[model samples]
Target chain A: MSTGGGEAEFEAALREAFERRGREAPAAAGLLEAVLARRRRQTRHRVAGAAVATALVAAGTLLGAQLLRGGEPAGPAAGVPAPGIFAAEEIELCLLPGGGDPAEVLLSAEVGGEEVQTAISEPAGDAFRLHVERAPGYTVRLDVLRGSVAGEPLDGARDVRAGDRPGRIGDAPGGGRVLLLETGTEGVLLRLTAEGTGPGDAELLAWAAKITVSTGRDACES
Target chain B: MEFDDYVLTRGDALLRFAHVLCNDAQRAEDLVQEALVRCHRRWRRIEHGGLDAYVRKAILRQYLSWRRRRSAEEGPAGDLPCAGGAPDQGIEAIGERDAMWRLLAGLPRRQRAVLVLRYYEDLPDAEIAGLLNCSAATVRVHAARGLARLRRHPELTGRAEVVEDA
Candidate 1:
């Protein structure tokens, strides 16, 4: 037989087979309900995922705004402690123990072009730290007295050369160390106290020595 | 028209069409159900167009792609039971129809789909190509190859080539 006849005859047979099937069709039954339920489930998942993502993004934005608004810097700079820890809490005079005589403020330091009153006070160690709050870092306590005090030798004091001046490094009553420097007529004591880490003794001593002291009258005296 | 009304009316015909595409009654039900579910999900967008044609295309796609699923890789030739509710046609006619079904099932699924679309559905070559997502030439080739294979079935064609009536 020719290809054309084969095509027509096979086609006829296929049609007959389908006609046999056309007699019985399955019921629609619950097909629509099943499909609609599937659609609803997909919609719920999509909406829930979108909602969670949106909530996360909004929370992140709010947290970022709050951090920016707070005076503390976002993160610590390289090799530096976090700024919030080191920032000064209060800037006031470091008064003496009796309050009758202030530690002779050799020269007041200028913070923002205004001379900030500087006095030396020996409070109970904890109060000393709380009252003498500077920026958020270790407080660099510098005391330059008019003359050396005749007191018992400080405990745990070790001899060290701070620049040309021979000084003794001793642990303070609180959690930091102090450097005692006697330069003939005037004596300087440097101490640093903070909640966390502080600068090395050599660094603090150097910082204490470099206090740009002016031989002017004390601001508290005026 | 509402989706419920449309399905209620046209669902039976679509099921029959799916049965012709895939001989298994259960598979046909699944195919039609999946297609209608997809249509319902996108009803707002597809409601403006002819929903019947859209659903027919979806059913054709589902049938075509069904073979790829490992679960759907069933041997169509093995399960050749006669469908329920046969017409008053004699047993000889039923045997001939079953013979035709086995012959048709032995062919490649794409070629069988081409035959079903062309002969059973009375679709033109171009229309079948659109439903199959192929070129008209490809449809014709599949049809020719499928018919050639069907003629080779010894029991159905009596070991003789089928001849077209002039």
Candidate 2:
């Protein structure tokens, strides 16, 4: 083996290989049509998912209204507080209960007459976690954890429970207010917590009562 | 240009580029197809003169990100091709080409990519850097190390003439 012709040989060999491969490469053929078809299907799926999420949100709102009917609601006193609303933005592909994309959900509401901007959450296991900045060095968060099963369904309390069953607005560890809501869906739970000069127990409960689900359907769903 | 036009002109070249990077036709096809799908999705957002570079970058990224699927059931360390051998004199051009492919495959993924982009794509360091999302200095480092590894390959050991060192 000599080093003398190695460079020439390597370059020549690469060129030859490229030419040979070009001769065997497939034509564009049906590729364009296939891509277009995929895009169309994704659009349809997104539209359908959004519709489903909207229906769920409406049902959940009804349930929240019913739950609040029995309790003595607190007045907003000096300022009107915003409801805790968890709205799904874009659902990621293959992360939903029905084998669709995971929804990009957010939590937003007004606190004390000021409109708090929206905030997105980080995905954690079967939950989406959101942290909202209330003031300098003070914050609050909402964790929406989901669970579902197919075929051997768990009745209304299991797979298909709507998103509005009320539990209790109680003390959470670390001095935060926690509202546990059994979402109308069987396996979904919305845990809303407010800490440091954030929403109070009554406000958090009201927010939980007004939780909404909006779907941002993913355009890349398979 | 329209997305379809871009695909018609650049699809085969992207496939060939993938083949060189992965050294397997099926894997190359899959990588190129995945990249094309992604490019199609973001077609409107991509700038002019950017699609080819974007697709190339996507293919390389997919190739590098693929998980190694070699099973434990396969033969262990002894299964690797020999690292030390003089380039066989009796072998024809096709054999030499294969020899080169083997040597190229032996390098680490990034080094192999740098060498292929440099020699096969004939891309300049700055451009290759842009495609790889790395600095030009890093590209040079990869190219230098890759060429050094090729020079040290056992197959090229006895070759009277070696390619110029990077």
Q: Using TM-score as the measure, which candidate wins? A: 2
Instruction: Give stretches of model 2 more than 4 Å off.
Output: A1-24, A41-222, B66-94, B156-166
Model 1 misplaced stretches (Cα beyond 4 Å)? A1-9, A38-222, B47-49, B66-88, B159-166
TM-score of 2: 0.50
Candidate 2 per-residue lDDT, tens place, A1-222, comes to 255556666555455555554444434455456555655665687689668656655554444334533343532331223422333322121113334434544443423222233333446786677544354333557676665323212212211222344455545545665566664456665666666655434344444444554343231121
DockQ values of all predictions? 0.16, 0.13
TM-score, first chain, each model: 0.37, 0.39
Residue range A1-222, candidate 1, lDDT tens digits: 346556456556567677667656555555566556656765687588556544543443343334322434333311332122122211223223233333333223323212234333443432222224343455444444432422424557666543344566666666555666553333323333323345444343434333322222332222
Sort candidate 2 into its docking category. Answer: incorrect
Chain B alone, candidate 2, TM-score of: 0.78
lDDT of 1 by residue, B1-166 (tens): 8888887788677878888877777777667766776677667777555777688888876776522222342222122233355467778666766777777778888998898788878889998898877999999999999887876667667522322442
What TM-score does candidate 1 get on C-alpha atoms? 0.48
Cα-based TM-score, every candidate: 0.48, 0.50
RMSD list, candidates in order:
32.1, 12.7
Number of colliding residue pairs in each model? 15, 43
